[model samples]
Target: MRSRSWVRTVALGAVLLGAAAGQAQEGKMSQGVKAREQIEERYRWRLEDLYPTQEAWEADFKAVETDLQALGKCQGRLGKSAKGLGGCLDLQFSLTKRFYRLSTYAQQLNDQDGAAVQGQELNDRAGKLGTRLAAETAWVEPELLAVPARKMAALRKARALGPYGHFLDNILRRRAHVLGKDEERVVARAGDMANLPYTAYNVLSTLNLPFPEFTTRAGEKVRLNQAQYTRLRTSPDRDERRRVFQAFFAALRSFRESYAGLISGAVSRDHFYTQVRGYRGDLESALDATNVPTAIYTNMLEQVRAGRPLLWRYLRLRTQLLGLDKLTYSDLYPSIVPSVEMPIPFDQARGTILEALAALGPEVKAILEEAFASRWIDVYPNAGKRSGAYMSGSGYDVHPYILLNYVDSFDAMSTAAHELGHAVHSYLANKAQPFHYSGYPTFTAEVASTANENLLRLFLTARETDPKRRLFLLGEYLESWRTTVFRQALFAEFELKIHELAAAGKPLTADLLDATYLELLKEYYGVAEGVVEIDPLYAIEWAYIPHFYYNFYMFQYTTSFIASVAIAERIFSGDAAARDGYLAMLRAGGSLYPVELLKLGGVDMTTAAPYQVAFKSLEKTLAEVEQLAAKK
Candidate 1:
């Protein structure tokens, strides 16, 4: 559920609105109250970790852009010899690494406080530079494909290219999909145009749109931005939760048509790429780069559908525990055991996460320690800082940067652990693999993060003796299972159905999307059986999700969470092999396909084994919680 920037050096096209860290209930700080200088040095991330100063960054920025000419000179000569190809690749990787450093620095500055105009300009410049780099280096893949398969094999034996054989082999494997020089150029040129919908969606969501303020039952006026809406939805006050839910969806419903149009454009863009690449559909088109089979996606949806009874059981248990006649959409979030949130300050959350993560081994523990001690995190919420938690791994040589508006709650601790998982993964990957292979695909990206959260749960649940407190922690874990696995699977289903309709030449109108989503919601929540009631207005929930524009990305969250459950179980059982295997998978990075690397880590996601394992784990936790509740 954590927002992530991944390996893409460019700024995110869509700024997703919700927080993985628990959201704040009000705007505690007035607008423009805190300047970047006003923050304590210890709490601020050391951007100097990447570049010592703005002057240093500017020098390198100019140098990297000029280095593109050096790259341009080697273009036509790549096929002259194996050594020539290796030299070109060496230069290419070097430039990209430097570019990643530069781009990530600008991104970190901009994210520190999103209001700084200078930061925004630098971020925009970095993005344009990235687009230019993509165009400049577009010839590499096509030209490499033009070489005979036999030549590539022979080239692998050459000492210079031997290190890159894995990368070269991947290119040759996708030979059929690689377009010719002119067509590749055309596709590359159209990249910016194809991204318009995403750009527009980000602007509309983060800046231009007006979110209404709502008054709570306490007679307090609160503005319902994305963060406030998320926080209030889980308020102990049922009336407040109801008000927040209605107001939030009402605001979204007003812009339903706009969202539909933007999302339709995104779907069409996917469809265009699918046809251009000769893939069967949009799903295959998206998965092709990672070399994952379409069956994995379909099987995940089927398995999650099969697990619906358990999902329903959990919901019924929640309703019964709350003593409600029937569970409504608004009632889904309040804690099962208590009416108040357990406050956890940032310093305490930090110690708890580090201790929980100790099971991963000492090497990882050291990385987390450095991250905290070295100001690698930009902690606390500020006047104009970006909301939510995300790890920026674009700093290749330097350490990863984590941005979080941490509130003192257990969820915030989980968010910290989740992001630190990413940091540790990147640190290990960069250390073990070369720059070219350091970045992981989105398919396996969430494994380490969610696995960390699993470890935290295992640590916390075992140590706590109070029955109600243990039940609360366990219920939160179950909610993670629901949201990360079941709920995301539902989202994956919606994405698939909508894409299918779009591919079949059906119009993606607001009514059509609303009805399709509402049906899926009913099926998943089992409204007919009285497990939960869905308000008609809640059908517009699809409009609030920014992930839909991400092009078949939500399914990976389900898959990764399931895989991590299996991985965390083995590691938590004190299995040395499992520990090493998980670390090795993180270190392997993009050198291997995601599925292959995961298989090496002892979770073969292509089969039903891991999915079944995950369900069993979920069932075990449910039984433990049920057993504890029975004692009362």
Candidate 2:
């Protein structure tokens, strides 16, 4: 469900798109990361869960590729009749499932060890296979639409086509946008070039970028890689954090020209598609894939802007807790409860997450138990392993696999809960729906994950008798909001502005991008209002975020975080119907539109009430933390 760099369209929807958020693993980073074989088997994910061995994976890949090639034989014949169409549809989903399985396996293996020659080979093969499938099946929609109108209506109602009704209907609904077969192939063939910018960025950031070993103020010599910077940014020593910030951003700023060009190319790719597809712009084209209204994106920006006072309120609280004269950009990452430590070892994390998510019922508990037991997760950072955390639940027949650079901190534990939320959502969807409809859309993707996080926060805050730790837990919830809700909206707005800039024919340069980013940083952190000083040093922060390449993917984090807050509150209130409805929505999956799915889950994202509830909840929680801080 989550990945890096590329996304490919499939029978159901945009199946393998990546969203950039290094959502977790904010603990200490190993200066010298251990080799993969150095980790215990239990800590390593069993890709054997998907395939027993590389030979098995290769065989499956060959079979899937061959089947995909065979599907090309059915191209123009798709409009022939109900049975013929249904047969082709069945083969399409069937092969896509195997294709996805192949992709997940290769990709995860590659991430688990980026330097592995086998991983690189298999990953490259998978990418080529995806391109082949795209070029081969490019005629599907256009041909499906070419069916005679009366016959197509009958096909929609045909019992043989019942499972594919929604999938077929989605294709038909995109009639105005679906290109002719030849044009579609032309676009599909452009996949490799279209992916060049992000691919380069991902390669540079993940593999090739050189991070210097910097000495901390404590005289701790550490390699300031992505994970290390993430961990050290939380250092309580102000001057030390300032040094870390300077070093990290200075490193990123050094490569700003390349990052700027790569991002501009990304925008240009979006721009080209926008023009080719007859969309107004990139945002609409991205959101429209799943029938999501662009209004929700704009509304999220407006709502977060409206909630800026709360942000400043929280920032002030943070300053007070840290005993700061004033907050600055470097002050952002250190825990407000600097004295409290929540170091959760990986084993302890399993029990903690299981207990936190217990309200989701026995089924979810069973899944978590299995997830921990079955080695469904790769649980530690290793030399050459991918950074950050993500859960892939796209392989319908196989269980979800999570990749975590777990260093045994509270954030690492929270990452487990968050990713497991995605796992359970996928498990339930796969269990309840046919493969054709097993995948949920991007809109609802974060709801379950963030809900699990809320559950963890609430559970910890309630039982934590240690006042300091309780404060830590409560502050973490607020921080989660700041990062997910506030930070993401800022990203969404920045993404919008840049795309608009490109659309207006302004060429993006490193300086221009930095200036634009600096402007947003000032506004969002309330520099003008003195909430937090926006250092120009952090202007290159955009270069560090991988999500800038996510093609309007950042806004979903804010919306889903808001939705999860509402969902978690209902369940916490003992609203039995709400809990059941929410679980049902997980099970509903891609069977319904995302808005309808949220309604089924007892929160209508289309209405103002959910957003209202979320903001009110933030206020109440802020008041609680403020009261507790007052006692201090």
Top of the candidates by TM-score: 1
The lDDT per prediction is 0.83, 0.82
lDDT of 2: 0.82
lDDT tens digits, residue span 287-343, model 1: 887788888899999999999888888998888777788889999887788743679
Pairs of residues at least 3 apart in sequence or in different chains that clash in candidate 1: none
Assess candidate 1 and give its TM-score to the true structure.
0.86
> What digit string (tens of lDDT, one per residue) describes model 2 on residues 467-554?
7787777776788778878988898999999999989989999888999999988888888898998778789988887677768877
TM-score of each: 0.86, 0.82
* Cα RMSDs, all models: 4.5, 5.2
After superposition, the stretches of candidate 2 with alpha carbons farther than 4 Å from their true spots are 1-72, 99-136, 146-151, 181-193, 196-232, 243-265, 343-348, 369-395, 401-409, 502-516, 536-544
